[model samples]
Target: MNSRLPENELDELPREIIDFAKHIAALPDEFQDDMETAYNRVVDSVRRRRRILGLVQEALAQLRLDIKYLMFDLEMTRRERDELREQLGD
Candidate 1:
């Protein structure tokens, strides 16, 4: 049987996964069923893990930006408080 994956699906998959799938496909017909099932499970797990990792990376970036904004606001507030104290003393 032809073992090549579709072009669109190949793009996101890592080389190792592709190679593993090709190896599985090379197995004898008697083992194809079990091997293909296991391969599908592995691919699904990898995709899920990748998606979670991407979400975490995105959240981390947003958190960093939020921290920068908060720092700026805190500095401004402190400066305003100092100015108010000086004016009162005068």
Candidate 2:
């Protein structure tokens, strides 16, 4: 018989406090539609921002790779042109 009941001590709370608690308890039901709408808006905003960041990151990486390739190609082209010019004695 060492069990304990889950009764709360808030039973002795003042009327104002109890009323406040009741109001808080009813908040979910009272603001149901507004809460749902706000949650969806927040979730959708996060998804959109994440997608935008992903796209930006991908674009930047590709641009960096492109710049690297372009620089390598430019250096190779210049070397080849110089060799040809020297070989042709021009």
Candidate 3:
């Protein structure tokens, strides 16, 4: 799909962070510690984001399942109603 979401989906960290990580190792020695700190922050943020996203995905999946089951039951009820009416010649 032509979407921005499926690209990194370990819960959607900003592209800039990934870019920074890719280049952090190339920074001068004096800046490496700061870069390391920033990279660690990005990792933590990504982890939290993934947890939240996982919960949301699970909830949505459950809602879809429930909707499907309810629809199936409603259809069955309608069929039963129709059969009973036919038997009663109504």
Candidate 4:
């Protein structure tokens, strides 16, 4: 499969599963390769996918934290602006 997803690759299916399918497509012919090696590759791919997912989850959590802080800061700034405006009689 291509390094990047093509338009057609987008679907209800998760990207990891789609990537796994792409990996499967590139796998060596079953009868031509050692079974153990093939199995190991498949296992490794699954492990990699899990790691990627964990990282994505961690990033999302951090983003949520950042957004929460930003919202609080925005409210505080708006309140300060209103106070300043009242003091200035504007």
Candidate 5:
């Protein structure tokens, strides 16, 4: 497989990823600080999303277990109802 990116897509990449030290050194101090702050915010957002995703997965697992129990209960109730009907007929 060709590892090289198409030229058009390459142009859309951030300069820092292409050449980190050179790109950061070329920028003014304030701009660099802003970039760092933005990067930190993105990292924090990803962490929060991962934590929420884990909680959602746990809830879904619990929901599946609850559904299984409810299905079993429904089947048991149906059997009891049928037995009661037979007894009443006899």
Candidate 6:
């Protein structure tokens, strides 16, 4: 198994987690199984959470843009209605 973690992962994950993985990697082959599995699980979980967070942030940004567009559309429609009413009154 590849024990070397990617540099980006090293930067994103907590130092303690990285240290623990390194410790597990350093173990003798016979002693590495259970702890290695646990470490892999933790790393996977963290990465999954980060991905989910990024998606949510992107969604929020899109929602904000949609809301601004809707607001502008509403204002333009109101102004047009008012202009038509003034022309009819004249």
| Deviation in Å, model 4, residue 7 alpha carbon | 40
Candidate that beats the other on TM-score, 1 or 3, i.e. the better one: 1
lDDT of 4 at 36: 42
Local lDDT at 79 for model 4: 100
Per-residue accuracy of model 6 over 1-90 as CA lDDT, tens digit each: 344777876899888888887788788998889888888899899989999999999999999999999999999999999999999999
Q: Could you say which candidate leads in lDDT?
A: 6
Which tens-of-lDDT digit does each residue in 1-90 have in candidate 5? Answer: 012335564354455443543354477887877765665465456557767989999999999999999999999999999999999999
Q: Which portions of model 3 show Cα errors greater than 4 Å?
A: 1-19, 81-90
Better of 1 and 5 by TM-score: 1
Q: Candidate 1 at 90: error in angstroms?
A: 0.8
Poorly placed runs, candidate 2 (over 4 Å): 1-26
Worst-scoring 10-residue span by lDDT in model 1: 1-10
Q: Flag the better candidate by TM-score, 4 or 6.
A: 6
TM-score of each: 0.90, 0.64, 0.58, 0.62, 0.66, 0.82
- For each of the candidates, the C-alpha root-mean-square deviation to the true structure, in angstroms, is 1.7, 13.6, 7.5, 8.9, 8.5, 2.2
**TM-score pick, better of 3 and 4:** 4
**Predicted candidate 1 versus true structure: per-residue lDDT over 8-78, tens digit per residue:** 76777888988888887789989988988888888789889989999999999999999999999999999
lDDT of each: 0.85, 0.62, 0.75, 0.68, 0.66, 0.87
Better of 1 and 4 by lDDT: 1
Please list the residue runs of candidate 6 whose C-alpha ends up more than 4 Å from where it truly belongs after superposition.
1-3, 26-30
- Candidate 2 lDDT over 26-47, as tens digits, reads 5667675565556445545655
Which should have the higher lDDT, number 2 or number 6?
6
Candidate 6 has a TM-score of 0.82
- For model 1, which pairs clash? none
